[model samples]
Structures are given as structure tokens and as C-alpha cells.
Target: MERTFVKDWRGVHKAALALILRCIADHGSPPSPAELQVATAAPSAETVQHMLQEMESRGLIFRDPGSGSILAAYPLSAVPTPHRVRLADGRQVQAMCAVDALGVALVFGQDTHISSRCRHCRADIEVSVVGERIGAYSPASAVVWYTPAAVHCAVAAEGQCPYINFFCSREHVKDWKRDLSAPRGQILPLERALDRARAVFNPMKGLGGGPS
Candidate 1:
């Protein structure tokens, strides 16, 4: 493994860790520095790379040579190849930006189309928050983590977001598309708890037996 000097940003950083987890949970991939740049509205690309390198060295993520982007630290399956995003409509839109950090900042990818799937993978590139969709067809969505049992729910669809209610199991999740006018952020505490748990997915398993 290529060893990189990493800085210690320790102990339950809700933002960074949440971003990392949200990336994989939703998009099936990690967010890159460039994506971070757009999401954070960074001044320059190099600044995003610098901070990203810091996170990478700390064993939270790995940089991919194929795309020159950051990927999750865990040994992942081959990126759900040819993953495409089909919109709510019958049209197949190209996806460029991918905001995976559940609910921090929006993450984007290399494709500039912003309306179609990436040429490389077909994962849903756009995301929507609240009633507004992020890319094109994404609806009010929230990635919720049910505590203890580790159930991860990432939903982007029409109707009210059932994830707002806190329940032990199955009540609200079954109704993800109910009441269209339900107040948002009602389930924020549940989201916060899930975001806090992202530290468990640390990328520092030691890059081994692969590209270095």
C-alpha cells in the first residue's frame, strides 16, 4: 500500500464522517474532492484536493486512479458497473453530480451533462433534498439509519418523507410516500444519530492486494 502522511482529525466529526457515509450509502461510491469543491462551493480545485488528500491519508478514503477521485476506504465491490439513473419519468437522464453524504453537502461527479448518467457508471448522480430534487427527477429524499440493528434507508421518490418520524421499526418507513405536506426536519434527530454513526465506516483498513 502506498503510505501517505495523514492528519489526526479525531472523534465523531459529524460533518466529515457523515459526508463519507452518505456517499456510499446512497451512490454506491465515495465522494471525490472535486465533488466536495462543488458541494462546499470551494474557491479552487486545488484546495479541495488538499483537504481530500488529508482525509485520504487519515484512512478515511482512497483516491482512485481510474477516475482520479476519492473512493471509500473499505474493500468495495467493483462500483456497480454501468450503473445508470432512470428518472421518475420514462426518460434516462445523465447524472454528473453525486451528493452522498446523506445530508451535508451535495457531491458531484465529472460528467458535465448534469442530466444523464455518467459514461463510466450508471449510479444515480443527482439527489434531491426537501421537496426539491437535486439533479433532475429526484424527489424529497432522506437517508435514514435505524439504530442498533443497522438498517440503512435511502429513499428518493414522490410523496411525503416517512423518515421524519422516529420509530423502533416499520411504521413510518412503510409510508414513505404519504402526506405530501408534512413538515420537514421532524425526523432530524434520527438523521443526526445516523450521521454520527458514520465513524464506523473508516477507510483505514490498509489498502492491500490492489493498486497502490
Candidate 2:
């Protein structure tokens, strides 16, 4: 299948985006508009809200319709997911997918420990990412199943995040794929998956507040 990368972020507010991501990494949750206004020194809460709306429009975030609070800020998620990451700073947060879990360390420029389960068998998997390399991981045979979104898919998180997953091994990936009438993606080695994660998230580093 063809690859579909992240959208361009030219018009998105780097500072605000950075600040929001930092808040999520540091606090395990997204900041309120009032909090963001105070942190970014925006003119008012209304301005912060507008900024958030812009971020949403650009596919940088997903928000709750009822409260207008952020549910995800890409890579990091406010709601729990299969992939959980523990930062070097001792705070824990949820990643949107397997690649997002690996990208956490690169995005923050810190070490991270990931705890997740295999997509097929649900067996526990753990990985340690140090600097730009994969330090260690359980079930040495682990691999990533990557399914990029359609070229015209509107939102990254909504379009393909759910399908990008970690399996205990390539054998499990094949087993899972066999059940599908037509499997439509690639099975990536751990290192290559990390590269994809880096490509997706590394640019966000230092954009607003410089990771924590």
C-alpha cells in the first residue's frame, strides 16, 4: 500500500502547539484554554480557544465536543489506549498507537519505557527507547503492523491510528492478516517503525516549549 504521511503544519501555531504537547507530557493531560492562555500569554482565553480550533482544523488535535477540551494532541492521548508510555520524568501518558509510543522518546529528547500488548494475542510487550535507538524490549520477535491512511483521509488519528499496532511477532501478524479478507498494509521491523515514528513527530520538538 502507498504511504500517507502527516499533514503539513505551516500555518499551525508552533508555540501554542508545543506548549500543549508539553503540558500533556508533563501533566498526563491537556491544559485548559485558560491554562494555555496563561502559559502562552495569549491575549485572552477566547484567543486560546480559537487557537485550539485552528489546531483541530489542521488535524493537530482532537477535542471533546461537549467540553471542547482536547482528547488527543497526536503522539500523546488524553484517553487511555493500548500503548502506554512512561517518560523519563516519571509521568505516564497514553500514545495514540505503537509508532506514537516509540516516538515519545524522540519527541521529548528523553528516554521512555513503553508498556503495551500485542494486537493479535494480547500478550504483554515492553520496550525501552534511549536516545535515537531501541534499547531493549521483550519478546525479541516483536514487530509493528503499519497501515497508512488514504491520501484524502481528513484526520491522522481518526483515519489510521487504530490500525497501526504492535504484534508479538511476524507470525502473529500473518495470523491476524489471514483472518482479513484482504490485508492492506506493511509489516515493519521495530527499527523501521521507529524511523516512521520519528518522521511523524520529531518536527514537533522545540516548537513551543521544548518538551518539558
Worst 10 residues of 1 by lDDT: 203-212
TM-score of each: 0.29, 0.83
Best candidate (score: TM-score): 2
Clashing pairs in 2: none
- Give one digit per residue, the lDDT tens place, for model 1 in 10-126: 322223444444455445566665655554545577756766666666555545556656444322211432213332222222221121222221222111112222212222333
* Model 2, span 161-186: residue lDDT tens: 54788899999999988877534779
Q: What is the TM-score of candidate 1? A: 0.29
| Cα lDDT listed for each candidate | 0.33, 0.74
Cα lDDT for residue 49, model 2? 78
